[model samples]
Target: MRAELLKPGVRPREVWAWAAFDFANSGYTTVVLTAVFNAYFVSVVAGDADWATFVWTCVIALSNAASLLAMPVIGAVADARAEKKKWLFAMTVLCIAATAGLAFAGPGTIVWASLMIVLSNLAYNVGETLNSAFLPEIAPESSLGKVSGWGWAFGYCGGLVTLGASLLVVTQGESFGLTFDQCVAGTMLITAFVFALASTPLFLWLKERSVPRVNAGSSTDSSGTITGAVAESFREVTRTLKALPRYRDFATLALCGFLYQCGVSVVITLSAVYASAVMGFETADTIFMVFLVNITAAIGAFLFGYVQDAIGHKRALAITLLVWLAMIVVACLAETRGMFWAAANLAGLAMGSSQSAGRAMVGVLAPKARLAEFYSFWNMALWVAAIVGPLSYGAVTWMTGNDHRMAIAVTGLFFAAALLALMPLNLDRGRRAAEAAD
Candidate 1:
């Protein structure tokens, strides 16, 4: 089956170009969202630990909610006009600009910093949605898992590189006559530049593959007025939502994805905070730990990419979720730094596997004509989880008097629920439905 689906003459350069976008954007995920900026925002910018937890969660929830509402509409428009690359490029620029602006956010600039985070995160999420939609275009069905895995692997490497650079600036800034705050600000500029430089190949080399479809309710004409295009996009989005129930398997998968990401998002967003609050890890220690996670995550992504193709995406995802469940348990029980480090590595393995397998599943299940729209739905699940996960964690932590372990324990329940949700998904049926639509 794999051999039959493989396209003999697919251009390798285009495949690398497509994967390069992942490599590009991961700098922001690592430096800003995961490692440096988030902790900085909470500890320095907000100036109160309890207040910072609540505010950070609120900011993340609000930003993710906005992106959730906007992505499907933007995706519909991009799909209608066959302009995925164009939309991707626009969002990329928005993300880079916002990330760069973070350099100006100092200790007394909470509002400014919060605004930058919201805008940069929104652009990053939307850009990622567009990027994932391109998978089916560049890779054959047989190789979707492998290609997605390669992209994730590249992303981890990119994170590692950028984080390593940030670590240097952070740990050695005093030697170079820069203060801690100045070094943190320098990392933001580094993130922006690395993202812009790494993403160049994607815009220049990858071509949009989908053609505009003829429809009365939606304008496929790229030359049409902007207002008309936007209106048509909204119409298409409404139509898709109404029609979603018929795609039961896809809907089930999306639900499962949302539940799983509830756990994943919380961990990704708050790991540094957890380490600092629970285990008393300092800035350099947290950075080094994240560096270790990225290394293992890259290895896990590369290995699990082939595993999913061999065993099936659904099975592979379930396995990853189980790993995630164990990770949460480990975090809950670990009282020592060594024990927490072990759990962190487990998280790295699950993170890479689940992400690679989940994206592959979406590529396999989505109708070719509406790939972007379906990925928009996928992004919606992620954003929704982003909202629910952090808010829930924040509430729990607040109620428990900043007990991060208890908050992390709650995430385990989300993983358990996600595994149960996956029980109802019929991957074969979903694949058949996608093929029939095609």
Candidate 2:
């Protein structure tokens, strides 16, 4: 099936190009969202821990909420036309430009910095929504699992390379004679470059697949009117929900995603802080920890990609969640840096697996025509979790005064809940039911 996507076709090159898109944009998620830039945000740019947490929380909450609100309407428009690629390109441009502009922001005007964060997040989420829809068009069913995993694998690797480079510049700031702020700003510029350059292949190579008519709950926007489409989109959501019971596996997986992804985000968001403030680890070692985790994540993506193919998405996700729970327990018990390293690796192992397979599961369960709409729901679930994780972490840290123990314990509960939610999805039974329906 992947062989077909790679061969001569209207979208052969396009398929590969679309896969590269993940590699391109992963820098933002890795460098900015979770690792270096986020570290910089809390430690330097914002400088105040409480203020930093508040800003991070606000930007994340707003951006994700915007992504949730706008996604369905945007997706419905694309799915109703042959212009998914165009919208994707446009959103990519928006993200890149906004991220590039981050180079200009410095130690003043908190509003500007916060705005940049929100805009950057908006672009990232928009790109994700459209990029996901492209997969079903390119990869056939037989190769979808591997192809999806490969794309994610590349993304993790890309994140690793950028993260390593960012750390190098950060560590060598004095010898290079640049201020720490300048070095940190350089990451945003570098982020923009890698994202833009990596994404060029997809823009040049992938042909746009023809869009089909609106699916069950979607509507047309031929009049180019926002008010009308917005009204209809609300109606569509209502209809999608009323009919959602039929897609039980999909709904359950979404709930699982909400819970576990929150756990994942909380850990990633607070890792550096946890190391520095709670465990008394140094900045360099913290960055190294992040680098190590990403490396492990790259491996995990491949290993679990295979696992998903063999055992199916539900079982694979469940196992990963179980592993996540164990990692949190280890975090609670660990007394030194060595133990934390072990926990980080364990987390990396589950991170990509849950994400890659979760997306694949949605692709498999959704109606083909409504793929974009369903992905909107998937993206929404992620944002809902995203909102909860960081805020909850901040609250736990504030209340318990033991960032290490309290944060890990709270996140562990989320993972445990996710595992419980995933239990009913017996792969064989689901396969039989799907087949029977067909």
Candidate 3:
């Protein structure tokens, strides 16, 4: 491979432009999806009170289920047509509209909030599906880890910055700061606008390539017109899954990813609420802790990119998983804010490493022609794992009636299982290179 082609297909300007979308859009997941809005909706806005947890769980389950149902079909269609950017743009718009709708959600509007969240999550999943599909088209396989790491790094940067602003506005308690309601509404509106604006350049810079073995007429209707797109997408999904079994490593990696993501998503998703409600930390303190984690996560992503290129993906992933398990163990046993911060730091280091390395490993293992389809399967597993995490956490909390610490401890077991499953896979240097070339 030439050194020139190892770089992203778009110029540096375009790469930054593309990455900014991740930076901008991540505010929704970081602040609204995981941290700020969730706590507010459950604790403050949902008045039927005891039913709050159940409502959030149902929304997550339904949203992830919808994404899983849609992702493969969308992936196959995008792969078949090689039109990732168009799909990406469409999803971005849908997400923007959904997020904007959240601005209307206020006290006693639990139903509206849940509907908007589901729609927002669906759009987030679709946009991520298309964004990931474009990775192989832009960067050479040899440099994929680095390029993907850059995106993660920027994403964390965005999360931290926007979340910092949210902290300032929400925790100020009307001492020249906006009320909680204003903060929530402002966050929603600004997040939507920024995400939509940042993603525009992707549609301009990305170039499409043809997919091998895709039927030219398959995306259209039976009358030789371009109707029934949804039905066509579903049929293609069926075709893709039937052929997926032949990809052994891809299948194994995806299963491992699914199990491991249960731990990962729970940590990020519940960190703020756990800190504030369980540990007796103030909301401002929780936000600061979140900032610390995001900073460490950005650094971890870059460092692990090097590790993935050097020591190998499976080993790097195993190392991170061990750290993750250890962190959870320590976190569960701790009693003070100091101990909690220490655990958060440890988790932050391992968090980005696991995700970036896992995805890079998938990039190497998947068949080049079916990259989009395989990645969609991988993403679906991730969201499914995410859904399981919160539901399980809520269920365990309700049953044991113990501290949230038990939920953290239980998530550790999943990480350990993923680590054990991955230990037997010997992905040596020569093998990884060969896989990448394919």
Q: Which candidate is the best by TM-score?
A: 1
Residue ranges of candidate 3 with Cα displaced over 4 Å: 1-10, 210-214, 221-241, 426-438
Global lDDT of model 3: 0.74
Q: Total backbone clashes of model 3?
A: 0
CA-only RMSD, every prediction: 2.1, 2.7, 3.0
**Overall local distance difference test of candidate 2:** 0.76
TM-score against native, each model: 0.96, 0.92, 0.91
Superior candidate under TM-score, 1 versus 2: 1
Question: lDDT of each model, Cα atoms only?
Answer: 0.86, 0.76, 0.74
lDDT of candidate 2 at residue 348, scale 0 to 100 = 90
- lDDT per residue for candidate 3 within 1-438, as digits (tens), equals 244634544566556666677786777787777667777776767852655655666687788888888776677667766667777888888888988898888898878888998888898988987787666666776777777777777878888877777777766647866677877777777778767766777676655654544464655424433345566666666765665455556667777888888888777667766776678776567677878788998899877887777776777888898889889988998788788888998888898788888777766766677678768878988988988877787677666663577777888888988877775564454245335546
Worst 10 residues of 1 by lDDT: 1-10
Name the candidate, 1 or 3, with the larger lDDT value.
1
Question: Which lDDT tens digits does candidate 1 get at residues 138-251?
Answer: 777778888899999999998988999989999999999999889998999999999999999999888787886666333545456657766766776677677677678888
Residue 92 miss distance in model 2 (angstroms): 1.0
Among all windows of 10 consecutive residues in model 3, the one with the lowest summed lDDT is 220-229
Candidate 2 colliding pairs: 14-206
Ranking by lDDT: 1, 2, 3
Candidate 1 wrong stretches, greater than 4 Å: 1-9, 216-231
Query: In model 3, what lDDT does residue 106 have?
Result: 87
Ten-residue segment with the worst summed lDDT in candidate 2? 1-10
